[model samples]
Target: MTLKSIHIEDTDLQIEVKEVRKVSKIRYALKKLIYVPDADLKPKIITKILTHIRNIIENKVKEREEKDHEIGIFIAYKGKFIKGMVIAEDNPHYSSRNRRAASFGWLYAKDYEVCKELMEACESFARKRGKKLLRGPINFPKSVGGYGLQVEGFDEQLIYGVAFNDPKTAPSLKEFLEDLNYKQDSEYLSMEVTQDRWKSGTQLDKDIKIRYLTFEELNNRKDEILDILRGAFYSVLPDAFGMERYKEIMDLLRNIPSHYYKLPKKIKLENDSVQTEFVEAWKKCYDREVITFFHLAFDKNTDNLVGIITCLPDLYELWKDNPITRVNVDVAAVRKGYGRKGIFSSLNNIGQLTGNMLGITYYEGTSIWNLNEDAIRTILPHGRINRRFYVFQKRIKNPT
Candidate 1:
C-alpha cells in the first residue's frame, strides 16, 4: 500500500485504486488520504466521510467486489494532502446498463486551485479510459452519500444522507465547477409534500386495476419491478438506472431504524457475498402501513403490471428513536406508453390519503431527476422543493 505519487510541480497526485490491488495496500493508501472535512463538507453532513469513507473503499477493493467501483484521487499541496475525489472508473453493473462516462464523487477541496487540481485529475483518468464524458458527485451505489452537488436547500435537513456541502463552501464549489466548463448534466429535486386533498376520488377504467404492492408480492416479483423500472426510466434518464436496483433492499441505512448508535445492518465484519438478509429485508421492511405507498398498477385485461411507485418510512426518525411520522417516496415508474395516463396520480393519491389518515406529518419525494418532466409537473404542484442537486458534466478529449 505504498503511496503511488505523481508529482505535478507543486501538487502531488495519488490514486488509491489505479494500480494498487493488494488489500493491505488499499488500507495503507486510504489511511494516508486527506481527512480534512472542514475544507470539503457542506452543512449537516458533519464530516461523514471521516468516519465512513474507509468502508466505501474497503468494500470496493475486495477480491470479488466490482472492479470499476471507485478509485480515490488525492491532491496534496506542499507535502500535505488537501483535496480528494472518488472516481468510478467504468461501471458496476451489466455491460448493457453501461454508459460511456466516469463518475466523480465524494468531492472536497479547500479552495479554487485545489478543486481545479482535483477535477483535472478526474479528467485525466476519464480520458485514459476513452470515456466521452465525466459527470458526478455520483458516489457509487446510491446507498452511501448518493449523487449530486448541493446547489440549493442548504437550510433543510440532510434527509437520508444525500450529498450536501458546507454552505459556505458549496457556492464556491458550484461556481468553480461551472467555471471549469462542467455543464449541468442533470438536476434532481428532493421534495416535501402535503398529504391533504387526495381522497380516492378518481375512478379507474375497469380494465385497469390498482392495489398496494404487498411485501409478499415484492418478494416474488422483483424481476417485474426491475423490468417496469428499466422500461419506464430508460428514456427519461438511463444512467440513473445504474444508480438504482430492486434485487434487494436498495439502501440499508435509509431503511432500518437503529436500536442503538443507529448501526447499519448491512455491514459484515468480513463477507464477500451478498447476504440473504438484505433480500428478505426488502420485503420485510415494507410490512408496515407505509407499505400502502408501494403502489402497483396492472392492465386488468392482461393482468400485466404497467405502473408503480414506492416509498418507505423515513427511518431517520426511528434512528433517532422517534415515532414514525413521515415517509420518503423513493422511486416511481410507469411504463413508456402508460406514463402520462394518470397512473402515478392514482397511486400517489392513495398514498397521500393513507398518510393523512395516519397523521404522518409530511411525505418526501426523494431525488426526482429533472428529465422526467411528467413527474415534475405531476408532483411539483402538490409539494415544495426542499433540496436540489446537480451532476455536472464535461466532454473529455478521448485519445482512443
Candidate 2:
C-alpha cells in the first residue's frame, strides 16, 4: 500500500492518504469498519463498494485503451477508511468549456476535522493536476453515481442509484465545505408521485403514438436508442454524453443481474387498436428476461421517435423486502423540435399506465435540474418535490 502522511496543524492527528488499486485490499480494509448501519444490508453495501472500486479501475482502463483522458482515485485513511475521492480531467478534448475538476464521493468522516483534511487532500490533488476548479461528490461521472450533495429533505427514503449521506454527517460536511469557501455550483430535485395520481387526468394529443420496448428490443436497436438519448440531452448536457460515454452506460446496464428481480410478464395495452409495430419489433428481438421499462413516443405521420422515458425497479428497496413496487424514472427526454407536441406528456401517460398494470404504486423522478422549466411544469401536476441535492465548487488558487 502506498501512503502519504500530512500533519494536521495544531493537532496531534495526522491524515494518511493511500492509493488503492486492488479490490481485495479495499474489501479487507472496509471489513474493519461498519460502513452501513443495517446489519442485514452490510454485505450488500460492501458488494456495492467493491463494485464501485472495480468500475473506477475499468474506467481508467477504458481511458488508457481509447487514449481518451487521465483519471485517478485516492482514499484517505486514519486507521480506517475515512474518506475517498476521484479526480479526472473531464473530457477536455470534447468541449472547450469543460472545467478541470475532481469528483468526490463515498465520503465517510466522523467529524469536521477529518472532513476538512479530506477536502484539502482533494484540492491538493486537483492542484497537482493543474486543475482550475473542484466540483463534486459526483463520483467520477454524473451518469453513474449522480451529482451533488443532499442538503434538504433528509427524512425521505433513498432513491436507487442516487448517493445517500447520513443526515448527521451531511450537515457537518456542508458546514466544513462552506467554511473552506466552497459555493453551490448546481442543484437538482427529486420528486415522487403515486400511479393513481399521475394517471387520473393525463392526456396526449391524437397525433402522437406511444410505444413500449423491452430490454431485448432496446439491446437490438442500441444505436437508434443511443441516438435518441444523445439528441435529447445534447443541448442541455453536451459535455457529458458522447458516443464513448453512452457505450459505457450501456455496458453497465447490460451487466445488471435481471434474474433476481420480477419483471412484467407481458404487455397489457390499454388500447388494442394502437399500432403494433413496436410489439412486433419486441417479438423479433426477444431474447432473455431483464427488468427494464421504456416508453417511447412517435409521430403517427412521420413514424419518428420523438421522446422517451425509462424506469427500473429500485434494487436496494427490493432487496429490503419492500415488494419492488416503486420504479425510479431514470431518464426522460424529448427531441428538440418535438418538445411542444405533447411527446413528454404522452410518455408520462404511458409510464403511469404501465406502472399501474405491473402493480407498481410509486414512481420516483430524480436528477430534475431547476433550469428545466418544461420538465418541472410537466411533472408538477402529478407529483410533489421530495428532496433537493446540490453540487459544490471552488476555484483553485494556482493552475500549476
Candidate closest to the true structure, highest TM-score: 2
Q: Write the per-residue lDDT of candidate 1 for residues 1-400, one digit (tens) a residue.
A: 2223444555355422133334454344444442323332322232333323444456634544444545544433434333443444444542222465676776666556656766777787777766777888775444336578887888776455355566667788788899899987788898888545533225345456675544466657777777777655435463554333453244442354333112133543223332232223233333342244466778867778887877666545554557767777877787767654556666776556445444456778877888776677677887888889988888888546
Alpha-carbon deviation at 229 in model 2, angstroms: 3.8
Which lDDT tens digits does candidate 2 get at residues 283-312? 432354533366777788987777878675
List runs of model 1 lying over 4 Å from the truth: 1-70, 73-77, 81-89, 94-98, 198-201, 214-216, 231-234, 247-293, 339-341, 356-359
Q: What TM-score, over all chains together, does every model reach?
A: 0.71, 0.77
Q: Model 1 residue 201 lDDT? A: 22
* Candidate 2 least-lDDT 10 residues: 88-97
Q: State candidate 1's TM-score.
A: 0.71
* Residue pairs whose backbone atoms clash in candidate 2: none
lDDT of each: 0.58, 0.60
Which pairs clash in model 1?
1-25, 41-166, 42-165, 42-166, 43-165, 43-166
